[model samples]
Target chain A: MLGEINLEKVGISCFFLSYLVAFAFEVTRLIKKSRTSRALMLLFAVAGLCAHTIFLLVRSRAADLPPLVGSQLDWMLVLAWLMVLFFLVYSLLDESSALGIFFLPLVLLIVGSTYFVGQEPRAVMEGQHSLKMAHAALLVFGISGVVIGFVIGLMYLVQHRRLKRKHGQAGGLSMPSLAKLARWNRLSVMLSFPLLTAGMLTGVGLGLYSQRTPEPVQLLDPVILSYGVVWLVMAVLFGWLLRAKPTAGKQVAWLTIWGSGFLLLTMIGLQVLNMDSWHS
Target chain B: MNLQVVYCTHHGTDLTLREKLAFSDEQTARAYDHLRNEFPDSEFVVLSTCNRVELYTAQESAKNVPTHQQLAEFFAEFHKVPREELFDDLLERTGPDAVRHLFSVAAGIDSMVVGEPQIVAQVREAYATARDHRASGPLANAMFERALKVGKRIRTETGLSEGRISIASVAVGDFGKSIFDRFDDKRVLVIGAGEMAEETLRYLHAEGVRDVVVTNRSIERAKMLAGQWGGTTAPFDQLDELLGQADIIVSTTGASRPIVSCERFQEVRRQGDPKEVFILDLGAPRDFDPAIGEVDDNVFLYCIDDLEATCDQNRKVRKKEIAAAQRIIDEETDEFMQAVYHRATGPIIRNLREKWNEISQLELERLFGKLPDLNQEDRDHLEQCFNRMVNKLLHPPLEVLREEAREGTPHGLMDALKRLFHLRD
Candidate 1:
């Protein structure tokens, strides 16, 4: 019975259902933890990851392009894939950490948003393959870092509130120390800002270079315009962070949350509206 | 089945009495020798700590199990206390109860400060010392090995061992650690040289805070506190300057009013290295002004009431986990007891099976001789039938014996089996 189901037929629904179940199990642990529930949670998460990998590979094979350049749907899935990888790594390293609860909902939304986004492949201009690759890779990584920072910020706030209230650590809700969270949050923003800026610069070069080509990227399109706004917000936050004094951990956490959260929301909201994205 | 424990823990005994009863390393060797002489057939392990002094002993035979009175007399003799006075203080448990008590102690549920990890190391070291002295046997080794695992299991599974309970520990662990990453690079300024200051200093030293400065009105007391902690002493009048220079301040001074007001702290902050400061006001009268907690974003201040409340919450948290921990201990205790009972019944059961199988083999050889004319297949079939019949007949008695062993050593059933089969030891 198990062997009858073919791996080649794996689809988004396959992994999507697995992740949905895995998320449910994770919630069960928070409500009432047991060894069995934790085991099931890990099992479903691993199964979902395997299915997700297979689906991505199969879809890339069908499209004759890498998932990053396949479409907006593929782009969102790739983002979710990176985050799921991070979530699994974090959850595996620390069994008691509450990363799954905060991380999974975001991953689910990112993956779920793929259904609403366009599947038309993005453009890869002549003689600019490497630049497009670099742009795609850098932005994917930078966005991943932003998502990680946002998650860590949320955790910092939760732990900070619990500490401020003088509450003992609740079972199955283990969080990192505020100092460690703050340090990671700082590094994520610091590292991702440079990558994002480089990605945006490469994108601009591609757009300017495309002016002489047959199909030029829509530089002032709604997608690009909204992305620019998000980038501006991040730039402001990064500048302030660099110039600011050693502020309290709570303030830093809030800033990271709002800054990263805004960038993600604008990108997703624009893609969901089916605006004329630059690559389309 | 022969295991026993006689102990006086902080739960029931006075601190003075426990201090007198606690065995030092030098005394433990001598005590082991004395116990060996008194009970040559028994395995012994002596666990001596500030909060508890337990004597875990087991014997190979139930008949050799030492009496409670004899063990009480031993403690009285060893401690040089009068027998009658020490007898009532020392409580005793035998068999399953004794195993449960050890598991509880190992898991930290029985600790005065529930969830303190020091007891696990203390128990491990005690067992190792007993092994070194050739005092521990297989039963004691099995119990202690399982006990260490039980401690780890309980710690991982339940929140019984989570969070810090003491005021000093909470101040350093809950708040101080949250603000600063490491302490070795930070300067520690301890005010007043009181007991609370000393305790907090000990925790800080453990966290690698080496640069310590103690100040007080009496230079002598300050010098003593500084000397004990390998730090320097500052004059009390230099409090403002010291406050500015130090990154972490623990003020336990018994002052009538707030020594470091918010205005004074802000003024001092200007001269200070503009870095984060952690102030733990462990003083009863609220030294360093509660208002200073909100004065600067970099300044994290916690007073006595704040730390005390956290400690109380920590205690309540530990109390809530006791039920969970007790469940684990109960389950492990039953499992351990069942294994012990099976170990006790092992030799008898093995001999019975071997003896009965020997009779079956001999009878089969005779029957084959009588049926020499039969075909090979027929003879083989008969032999299989006989073997099956022997196993089927023995199954019921063996099942009964195993069931009986789960509760305890099935001594009566084993004796009856030996007699009925005319078996030798």
Candidate 2:
């Protein structure tokens, strides 16, 4: 059925087309101020979001699992989904137009890479218990939080720089103030730390539980080692935030962005290389 | 009828010229009386603001309205300024352009802080005062009332007033209010009596801040500023004590080093309620260290750059409203021109109606006298029929005259109608 429909191609292309329409609509707001233009922009965004959701749902159905607990394609889709969800929620909260201007390109970059990258399904334990699913769910949620933290941190630094430079807010692009962005960055770190810990704990339980199987899980694959290293760095940032006397918000923003960004890259690279520890 | 405006506004003239040209209330009333004496046949309304000085005049003849040079002379004589000083600065617009200009100014489209609401009120006050002094007639009255409507339309239809577009306004309006609940309850400490500080203090006072303390390096200057604003002068040495007590600290001193360092402010914050304090450091060489902004969650310190950055963003948002405002101006220009043309043709219309009605009434009476055998009901129906015939006969020419008025005043057509119909002016 999936082969006959080419669901992946249709769904992805439809969402991209919607984004194209949305971008054009948003640009028109530069020339004229109208509530109609704003409404139309939001309309196109929701359309794109709906198409993106459908594509992921179809892919997950083909793989016979929830999208987050499926293949590498599903993992990247979850991240994109999280990012878009954040954009929609935040844009609605404040009539701020800056989020789409900054984050849409990143979304496009992630979505674009899905074309060239591997979409093959990972091998599940022959008789998979629900614990493995729980483990994947926890990890997916945790990674999504880290991605959010990274983006918000990037925003915080940009806002901090603009404020420090005294370069007034530019047209059509308004970031949250330094004070608000700092608060968001701080909250993201504090929240992501606990979620990430739960994710690691769940993964460890899955690894120990799967060890009794005929093909026992290995603990020291590059994916696991890299995950450990990334998690450790994030822990250090978390600890510093808790102890440090109010540091400059920009410095904290940059550190969080780079540190979390590094972890994300390594994790995605390990997946793209198909370096799962279960096979090792 | 013809209308014209000779003016110099915030855009065309500097503040110095505007101040010199401005009319105080008494002066404005006297100017209106003088204008009546000088140009007895014309209608006049003088609009004066901190940013602009405009005189709008309307008359039955373009020859009667004051010229740019004459209006300049009027300003010179009225304000005791030299004509040579202001003649080059003043500009004039006549007819439709004049109408459009007044509409734009009244709507705040020509404002220094575009979309500000004060200009509309100023326009209303000008018109009212002109009426009070019997300075405006039908044409000027129609123009001003329509302009007020146009101002209301622009505000309701556009997002021009959605954001704070100035550093002084946004800092005090957005972030400052978010930090403090009320300004009247707080003690405002102004450091370095510079222009930015003065401007910020003015906005603060406008927001109901009364208990202000001025501290500067120069004692005399501080005292002078404090005296002007009804605030007490704090000695320069007491900056630390004042810093701790001030709920709001606005620093625009041209200091070479950090006037309020993190260490200095942190000690100050300890003595005060640790809830919240708003500090606006507007100096170029950095009066307060940026590190001080990081001292606490409650201490929200914004420098000139930060506040200005928000203001720049607001300007972009405002730029989007320009098209909307222009559309309003265009619509209003059409409406006003139509009304003015109709007014120009009004007397002829009335004379034509009266002449035709008299002929119809006389013919109906003659017909009734010839046929007394007809019933009273039939005579009444015949009277209605003749009145309808007169109206039907007049409709086509009236329509053509209206069409011609749109292009212009229909001057040739109007003269022809008056002669052909034996209409009296």
Candidate 3:
């Protein structure tokens, strides 16, 4: 009966299959390009995005909560949905650059991870107050910045490599120059630091508030400590960037990629392992 | 239709041949008169530039059209050059290739600098001059107008002309622009009178750099170069002093050794204003020391290599655009071929349709005379049914002929259609 039912059994696979098709269309443009082909590529992407949005909405409705706050199923799809939205808007503005080459893999990773990662809701976050809700929202947004910064830095390095080697700009694989990428990376760190700091502060406040209630929240957990360390690294980068005379765009891009990339890996690793303070 | 272009382009000829064959505006008018007198049925438009000398001719029939050898002979006689000397340099393209070539040239896809904006203006000027001399026909008018539209489309729809790809331009437009908002107040010091130096000075002048000081190893050369560009000449000995005062320094000297050493430039930097300075080193071994680029944050030094890499990147982008533009050309070529083929078969198709209708009318008239008691409405309905059946029977063969038109003129099929359809012309 469960296998035969369409809504619960088939929605996730159906939406994900569309994304795979859209990704294939984006790749196909490199070989056979036409105005119609380009439009079709966009059409597939929008189609997949519509299906993805619907699937997530249905899951949230069935679970009776905001998608990201509901369960692992909701959280993973929400991240992927945001990524697709960002890629679609940005790619529409500048169709020449290969933004999909970098961001699509991340979308796939999140979508793929949902299969392995369980869908149990964290008991602590089920009926959290407004301040606790603010903490989770801030953390998600902050992590999103770090993830984006990593991707941008990776693109900068690739562009810089092409320039340094004197190779022609590869067809269907152009990106912004190191100069522009570095500027974005620096801004990302600047923005991510303040948001992350506020998120951490709010988290601490929520923890203290929850300790007075029955749960007795732990402040010195490993996940909390690792997050603090990631915040500290961003703070250092931000301070150095502001004080330095002028760093080369390439050097800054490399540093941001390395630093932010490590933080992102740790965050994702924490989520996957379900260890440290973040365990349900 | 007969269309021909006798062109000495950069592909087949050198600047010397182009120059010898080039016709100024007054000379072009005289040539037009000569052409009209020699071949009254032909239409002519002469395109003369620093790089190309082309004479395009169009006529209603191929019999009056000039051959390749005849065009070469004309060029020799007109320019007073020997026939042997000019014969090899003149290349010819006829009919469809000719139209495609002209379209590419007007679009700048065939230019040395792909997608350069100047060629469109050159083409427009050439067309206007031809019109003024009464040298163009309906075909030339239509062809040139369509070429202009294609040029506009290639420029606006594609990123073919997005960046300046020359070293002189990249240095001034990219790095210089990033440093200073305006160059009108900047002191431009050019350290050589080479072609590169002249080109850099021209760009600077266009950017409104007024106070240009030219210094070369040869003062006479510097003075001559500066005089031509309307700039002051400085002595070779005062190169360091000139460098100190220059807000923007462009060195294209042919010195084997480094002209501006790290220490020498640092010394000049000490005397100069502590403000930012833009240096363009356009030498092979590099006129300025490579370490000079790292001397200070204010000194924005770009050597030939850096500017060259950027130029090369832009060339690659243009190369990509060529593929897109070629696709458009191929599509247009097929459509043009179809139209020309259909025009070729127009007489036979019209005659066949008229002949069939006459036969149907005669047979119907015979039948109606035999059956005079039949009603007028019934007779008319029978005639309509018979006409529809005739059209349906002719449809399949005619469709094949139309499809064949997309290749060449479809001359074989047109002759075959005439025989089978009992079409007379």
Candidate 4:
């Protein structure tokens, strides 16, 4: 029965539209902060996340694989799912923290990118398949960390700018304080770098284990090299964050934005654009 | 029959004059006594707060209500202020306008800091005081009870009192809290023993700040302020040392020049590892140089004008709620006035009913005497029928009189009815 599952009703467009409307409501909330708009924003976000989860499940059933291991398209959608999930949970905790303004756009971007990305599942090595799954899973969770870091960095910058400009707290828009944002930003960088590092080590181990397979994974693979570059970028960010003073919130926020932004663009561009990667 | 408010508020009066006119607890009692003596027939409720001094009076007879000038003279005589000095600032509102003004004041839109909650309590206290003094009557009771209800409705139904608007509150709540997550352990350095500093300290203390070090040229004053806050004081000469250690600084002084220059602040920063420090310069002339804010990323220096800009913006946002609140106030005012006017017609209405009943009774008596052989049951039945007919006859004109009273007192219609029916007042 699970093998016979079909996606006749749900699709990426369903959640995409929900997220788009949520983002619209969030933008409207910026102009006029009201509980109605804030509630609408959360409602749509939760709806989008629900549809997003169903969409992933339907695709997973169709592919006979988990969404993270299904394809680049499924992978990106899963990333968006995590983001929308984060937004829904955090927004519940803080009814109106202006988080949707920073979060929903990223979700929309990731979900929208799935349309252009590859939907066909990658060819898995029959013997080392679980290792490959582990590799993809770590990278997925690592990228989630970076996405959150990017969002927190954006919030920090916004709050810092608001304070420096001496604007009164806007009526409906309440962002996290610069102090809290800075702390979250630092934690994201610290936590994500190790996740990405462990992910890199697992991918290397997976490649090394693939020597017994028919198509032995290459050392100079584009997938490996591209990800290696991302790791280097994250490593530098991680190193800088550790040495930076706690007082340097604005600078830390800027660096996190840059690091996380670069990581997202490179990873998304490689998969969606079908850039010359050995995995494809 | 009439409601009038003679108010001298922060809106139009000089602050110094308001201070002089403000009623202490004893002064309020004395004023109530004088008001009772001067106007024996009037109902008076005095609402005296730091922002306003208002005498609200409700009179049973509109014809003999005290004039605005008389109230102004009363204020002058009681406070010993000159007549000319107090008269121009004393404004008057009567009828529905007076009711609307009271509603607005109770709801806090008319306060110096719009939507401040303190005014509601102050208004409530005034009403309670008036009742305690045996000054408040039925009309006063109705007005104040409804005013408090209006205040609560406005507060709940609208976002009037949602955010902080005062300078010290805004400084500590919005700006300070945004910069620091916890305040209990944050070392607070207060430079100068001024009101703004104390106010800011109050907000900080509420935020759980315990370590407060006050420094001023007058070390004795600094010690006094520190003692009140459960902290210690430092000499003015140690301000530079204090600056290096403080995580938060609030300065307000009468100095002619900047107390902390950029170079001097830089020297202090160099004495220790530069950390996040929030500085509030609340002085008119600015005790800290503006350039000190630009010294480093760790130093957040805000002056009076900067915080005022935010306060002004917040105040403008609150002003938008005025229209929303006014809609409620307008509806309430009309309803209250109509009720007052309807109450005004109470005696005439009773008299009209009585006059018609007397005429009907006399005619019934004549008919019963002529038909003396009629049984008691038949006679009662006839009388019941006759009474129903009289009520049916009076219904149209009486209903008209009641309807007219809703729009206003209906003085002309009442007089006309009295003349036509030969009804006594």
Candidate 5:
């Protein structure tokens, strides 16, 4: 009976339902801390991640391309998949931790956005295939880093507020120490910015290379302009982080949240609006 | 078996009264000597701390056991406390209640700060002192050893002592330790040598902090606190300089305005090596400006309100575990009482069995003398029959006595058995 079920027929709902159940288990931990609930959460997350991997594999095989460069929908799914990988690893290490409560909703949002985004395959020039793959891979990794930095920044702010309010870790919503959270937040930002900068530089190289081809890419496309603005914002944050004498942790956290959040929103919004010149 | 405890704890009396009733190590040793002289047959153990003073006594005989009033009188004489003042304040527990009380005390359920860890060590020390002074007997030793075990079981089985509840402890444990991995190498600067500052220093000192620089407006008070913690005193005028040098700052000044402003702290930060500094502001009228926390990433400034909030939350968590802890205490108390009651019947049971055996032997010897013409095998068979008859007759009464001991010592039944069997204590 299991073998009779076609893997291609498995859609977003299969893993979405699994993740929903996993998130519910995560909530139950706060109401009453139980190892059973923690175990169940892990089990469901792993199951969901397995289904997620299978879905990406099936899609990639059908499209005859890697999921990272398949299409906007596949790209978003890959991002969500990386986040699930992170959540699963962290939850397994610290079973009682509430990281899933913060991370799962964002994963769900990205996965859900894939429903509205275009799924048509993007055509690449035969000779430029390797460059496109590298560009997509770098951007995917960089964007995922941005997402992680955003989440960590948000966690830092929440932890800082709790410490400042002098509330004990309440409702089983235990967080890492503010110092540790701040350090991770800083690391996420510091690492993501360089990856994003390299990704942007590579995109510029691709754009210039395409200018000499029969179908030259438009530099003033709304998508390219918006991405450039987002990259510029990130660069500013990067400069401030380097020059500032260890800026207040809260300030760094807030700045990271805005910078990374803006980048994610712009990327998702442009894809959903179908205003991109390159991928479309 | 009799057990009694005359105590004044934070539950019934204030700290001042407990202080009056408290005994020093020297005083406790001397008191044990006096306790032995006054009640030669009784075993004694005295537990004295800032929160409570308890004297536990156990005796084999009821007539020689000290009364609650007698213990109160003894405390009055030994500690120089007035009888009228202490008589009403001292609470008494007897028998099972006494056992339950000690178990609860050792478990930290009866502490002023519920689930404080010091009480367990205090109880251990008290038992050890009694053992050293030769004031404890077998009964006292058994009770104390079981109490310590119960304390450990409670800690393992419940989340009673999971969180630190005091302001000083919460500040250090929740925030300070999170900032710095080790305290021994950190330079600590304590501002304003007051009670709160001293308490915070005590926790820091316990965390391996040695190079303490105490600065206060009152030089004498600074010197006193510095001397207590084996720290050196810095001049009050050099607070800025001290702030620049220290890695951890504990400030509890009673100043009206903010002592450390954002701008002033900025100057301090500029001069110092860029390292993490944890500032515990324990003042009510807020010594450091709240904005100072936002001054830089390395500065972690927390006031009393912040620490108190964590303490309050921890107290609530501990309070939730009390029912579970109490259940353990109840089960253990019942088991202990049954054992004590069973022990109370041991000698009587032995005596009754011995008396019956002796009577059977005497009867068999007489029968043998009267029936000397019987065969050797027949005489052996007769002796076996006589022994069986004696055992069968003794079984039912002894079984009933053992059953009664399970609930409690069957005093009336025991008395009847003693009279009928002519048993001695």
Candidate 6:
């Protein structure tokens, strides 16, 4: 049976089904604190992650490029895949936690949105392959940080509300202490903003380098401008976080949600629109 | 065997009654001496705590076992309480019910704060005291040991005792720890030297608090409390300055009016650098004004009502684990009862076996003498065959006795076995 099964034929449906089952198991665990459910959830998550990894590798091989620069579809899948990696690791380490309930839906959103985005591979500018690769890698890692920041911020707000309302830790919705969440949230933004800034700076460098080549890229591209605007918003948030005294955790959580949520939305929305850009 | 417990706990009796009925160390020793004189064959153990006063007694014979009214009368006479006033509050349990009640108490399922852990140690200490005074016999030892084991099993197998349920602990652990990362570096200022304040300080001290300044209207009381925790006393008139200096404040005064109003706290905050302040107001009438919490983002104020709300939520969470805990208790109780019942059949079974064995030996010796020409191997084989026949004959009645013991003591079955086999107990 194993020899007869074809991995190349595995579609988004295969991994999507696995993740849905895993998420359902997470929900069941909350209702009935069962170690079996938690173990099964992890099993399904690992299976889905394997299939997802193979799918991305196959797509990258077919395109003759890395998945990060293959297409908007591949980029979104890679991002989703990274998040699944995070979720799986965290779930394995903390078996009783219900983080998958919060994380899996976002993964599904990104993976599902890949269908509407462009699938055709973009042309790699001559002698600019490495630079473009660096740009894409930086942006992916940076955005991954933002995604983590958003999730931690969400957890912080939840923990804050529970503490403020004087409700003990919710039965299955246990989270890190407010102090720990605040620290992690601060670290996420502090680290991600610099990487994002570097990624943007590299993109500008790529833009400048591409102008010297025969296929000169426009400096005033709408995609580039939109990215710059998003970067500025994050930079402002980053600055506020650094300068502000350790404020109330709820305020920090709200700022992180808005900042990271905007970045993710703009990045995915711009790519889906297929705006003319040197990278794509 | 007969076992019973007469008890008054927070569930059915008020603190005043429990206090009046409670036994101190000296009283417990004196009571045990009196009990030994009054009832020579009985075993007694008294468990007295702030929340409850329980007297457990076990006897080998039902004729000598203490009745509910008698135990109540003993309590009335011993504590000098009027019989009518104390009798109604004293509840009684016997036999299996008594065993189940002890298991529940040791496991903290019967506590006012369900799943509190102090009851386990309290039960253990009570048993130790009883043993030290030579008041506990073999039956009481077996029962109390099993109760302690059941308490440990419940704690490990269920999440009943996983969270803090006390008001002071809930305030410090659930809310205070959430605000600040470390307590050792924070300055702690206690506003009053009330019991609640000292309790809160105890919790904080366990969290590694070092810098503590206590201020109360009575300087001597403040000094006493501060000296207890290795802290220094501060003048009550310098409350605002101390408030500005401290990061965490615990106020538990008996004052009828709010001590720290919003305007006063706001002024104190303005004098200090903008930093986080965690305040626990444990007074009933509200030591700190409720408006102080809304005055600024830095002030994280929680009063007794807030802590009680958290405790209520924790109690509900603990309540969810009750069914699981009850299942464990039921299984343990049944096992213990079965053991006790099986022990009751021990003497009859032993006598019956010995009587049959003596008859087999006599008959075998006569047969060997008659069959002198038989080989040694054949003789040995014949003896084994006779032993198997005797075992097979005894199996049915003994099996029935063992089966009956599962439900109860099987005294009637033991008596019938004794009569049929002509065995003496």
Residue B39: error of model 6 in Å?
A: 6.1
Residue A131, model 3: Cα distance from true site in angstroms: 1.6
Q: What tens digits encode model 5's per-residue C-alpha lDDT throughout A120-209? A: 777765567777778888888888988998988998787766655555565545677666777778888788888887887888888999
True-contact fraction per candidate equals 0.32, 0.08, 0.00, 0.50, 0.16, 0.37
Which candidate tops TM-score?
A: 1
Candidate 1: regions farther than 4 A off:
A1-9, A20-43, A90-97, A122-127, A155-168, A172-183, A214-219, A246-254, A276-280, B25-41, B60-65, B77-80, B133-138, B270-274, B346-399, B414-425
TM-score, cand. 6 vs. native: 0.84
Clashing pairs in 5: none
Reference-based lDDT, each prediction: 0.86, 0.79, 0.76, 0.86, 0.86, 0.86
The C-alpha RMSD of each candidate to the native structure, in angstroms, is 4.2, 6.9, 5.9, 5.5, 6.8, 4.3
In Å, residue A118's CA in model 5 sits off its true spot by 7.0
Q: After the best TM-score superposition of candidate 1, give how far the Cα of residue A252 lies from its true spot, in angstroms.
A: 4.7
What candidate 4 gets wrong by more than 4 Å, as runs, is A1-8, A121-134, A208-219, A276-280, B14-22, B27-43, B59-90, B131-138, B152-166, B320-324, B335-406, B409-425
- lDDT by residue (B157-206, candidate 4, tens digit) is 77787667788988987788878888888999999999999999999999
lDDT of 4 by residue, A1-280 (tens): 5533544477888889999998898888776667788888888888878878888887787789888778888888888887787888888898768888888888888888878878888776666677777777888888999999999999888787777767778766788767788899999888888889988998888778778778788879776798899899999989988888888888888888888898898887887768655576
Residue A239, model 6: lDDT of: 88
* DockQ scores of all models, one per candidate: 0.32, 0.07, 0.08, 0.45, 0.16, 0.34
lDDT (tens digit, per residue) of candidate 5 on B179-295? 655788989999998798899888999999999999998899999999999899988889899999998898888899988899999988888765778888988799999998887
Indicate the residue-level lDDT of B279 in model 1.
Answer: 90
Across B268-334, the per-residue lDDT of candidate 3 in tens digits comes to 8777765557788888778999888666645667788888888887787778888888777666655
| DockQ, model 1, C-alpha based | 0.32
Better model by lDDT: candidate 3 vs candidate 4? 4
Clash pairs of candidate 3?
none
Please give, for residues B1-425, the per-residue lDDT of candidate 2 as tens digits. 78889899888788898899988999988988898988998999999998889999999755566777888888898888888888888999998899999988877879888888899999999999999999999889999999999989888788777678777787787676544446788788989989888888888998889999999999788888788789999888988899888878888889888887789888887776564567888899889989887776556688877787788777777777888898889888988898888878888888899999999999988998899899989988999999999999999989999898887788899999999988877
- lDDT string for model 1 (B104-137, tens) is 9999999988988999999999999999999999
Error of 3 at A73 (Å): 5.3
Q: Where does candidate 6 chain B have its weakest 10-residue lDDT segment?
A: B58-67
Question: At residue A83, what lDDT does model 2 achieve?
Answer: 78
